[model samples]
Target: MKIFPIPCLEDNYAYLIIDESSGEAAVVDPVEPEKVLKVANDNGVSTVKLVLTTHHHWDHARGNEKMKELVPGVRVLGGSFDNVHGCTDRLEHGDKISLGRDVNILALHTPCHTKGHICYFVTGKEEEDPAVFTGDTLFVAGCGKFFEGTAEQMYQSLCMILRPLPKQTRVYCDHEYTEKNLRFALFVEPENEHIKRKLLWAKHQREANQPTVPSSIEEELYINPFMRVDMPEVQKRVGRSSAVEALMELRRMKDNWTR
Candidate 1:
């Protein structure tokens, strides 16, 4: 399986998950349909088979109608609870779908950023590494703000649901927030060398105009303070005892954070 990230709007990302065995692809948040189709055509994909809408947000789901108009029979899918603009199908949690021959997609209900935010976990039947499209639920070193949910929901979505994925599973999120997120991670855990190194690396990547996503679950555990609320370092910095409190404080701090 091959995944291509297409930059859309300001910092948003649209991803293409292509099954190599066949020239079929599933696109995630194709907010810029023309660019996405251009990339797809550049690759071996002749027709896009699926459209995976992560949330109901305009930046994420705005181009669904255009995609429908572009691809005649493409199956557009969104979470069962979300009112996605042009969704042809509503998906429940744990719904499994196949793309071409090797790509297997699983929908996970991670609903903190939005009430019906769905993160797509994808794996290949062959030897390809697994991946998860986290939308606005999870970033490189920070999770999304509590827009429509509480701290407990964010904790459950980030820690309980996403934290247990395979350590090497590549994480793909919705925005180009890695540099800013790593800065926040450093503020949360100033002494964490992992965060420092990753921050520097992210700096270099941004300077060179490269994407810093596809961060592995293991890397996030080490550098992402939101996912490490139980750690003594994170709790001490946040002055919170429990994980939920720490997570809430972190979210508050991030929400008010200027730099």
Candidate 2:
């Protein structure tokens, strides 16, 4: 399986997951249909068989109808609980969908940013390493806002659900917020050398107009403050003792971030 990032409006991203064996592609959050289609064309995709939507947010799911009209007979998928536009198949937790022959996508419920937010975990036969499509629930160095749920839900989604995945699994989130997020991480953990170094790297990547996505679980553990909430140091920094409280405080800080 091959994954290509299609940079969308402002900082958003849409992805093309291609199964090499059959040339069948699964598009994730085709917010900008033309950009996605252009990426698909450039990649020589024979057919687009699936449209995987992570939530019902307009910026994420608004292009579903257009994509469906463009790619006739394509299966538009979204979380079962979400009122997604043009969703033909409503998926549930642990539901597995196969792309082509080897690229298997497992939908995991990761609600917090939205009550129906879901993340897709993808693996292929030929490709030993795996990749996860974390829409807005998890970012390169942060987690999404708790718009529809609480911090406890976000904790479960990020830690218990996404964090336990293979440490080597490449995390593909839906935005270009890594540089800003790392800056916030630095403020939260002033003495964290990992955050300092990652922030510098993110700066260089952005300076070159490059994407700072595909952050691994291992790297997130080291650099992401939200992912490290269970640690004593992170908890203390947030003026919280329990993991859930620490997570809540961290999120509040992120929400109030001005720069």
Candidate 3:
């Protein structure tokens, strides 16, 4: 299983998951159809299937109708059918979708970034680690903003839904925010060596114009300020004695951040 990270529309990402053996492919989060179609066509893979949406946000699902039109008879799978454009399949928790030989995706409903956000877990065929498509829910160094849910919901989604995944799980988020997020982490935890090291590494990756995604969940636990809200140090820094308050503070800080 080969996952291609195609960056789209002003930091947004739409992925192309290819099955080498069968030469079949699935597009995850098609923010733009032309780029996705061109990539798939150039790679000689069929772009007749898609994992429709992470949420109803335009930046995430804006290409749904165009993509369906570009590839007639395409199967558009999403979390909800009501608001989703051209949704042919509505998926929920514990649903498994097959791409090709040795490629199976398990959808986990992680609703914090949005009320209907879902993450896709895909295992690689060879020695490669498993990959997760965490659309707006979990990023490399930061989680998505709470647009439709609360901090408590985000806590559960992180601590429960995403934490249990294997430590080596590669997180493919929907944006290239690792560098910025690491900067925010530095502001939050000036004494954290883990964050400092990650920030340096992320800077190098960005300098080389490479994708800074597929960050391990273990790394996120150590460097991401949002995931560290449960830590006593983070609670103290946020001027809060409770984990919930810490999370709220972190969220508020990120919301007001300019740089």
Residue-level lDDT of model 3, residues 1-259, one tens digit each, is 8888899988989999898878888898898889988989898895556554777788888888888888887787777522666678888888888887878888888887778787888885868789888888888878888888898989888878887898898988999998999999899999999999988988899889888887888888899888888899999888998877788889899989988
Clashing pairs counted in every model = 0, 0, 0
Candidate RMSDs in order: 0.8, 0.9, 1.6
Which pairs of residues clash in candidate 2, taking residues 3 or more apart in a chain or in different chains?
none
* TM-score on alpha carbons, each prediction: 0.98, 0.98, 0.94
Rank list by lDDT: 2, 1, 3
Relative to the unseen true structure, what is the C-alpha lDDT of residue 144 in candidate 1, on a scale of 0 to 100? Answer: 88
Residue pairs with backbone atoms closer than 3 Å in model 3 (clashes): none
Off by over 4 Å in 2: none
TM-score of 3: 0.94
Taking the tens digit of each residue's C-alpha lDDT, what string does model 2 give over 73-128?
A: 99999998889999999999999999998899999999989888989999998547
Give the least accurate 10-residue stretch of model 3, judged by summed lDDT.
46-55
Candidate 3 residues lying further than 4 Å off, grouped into runs, are: none
- Alpha carbon lDDT at 145, candidate 1: 78
lDDT of candidate 1 vs native? 0.93
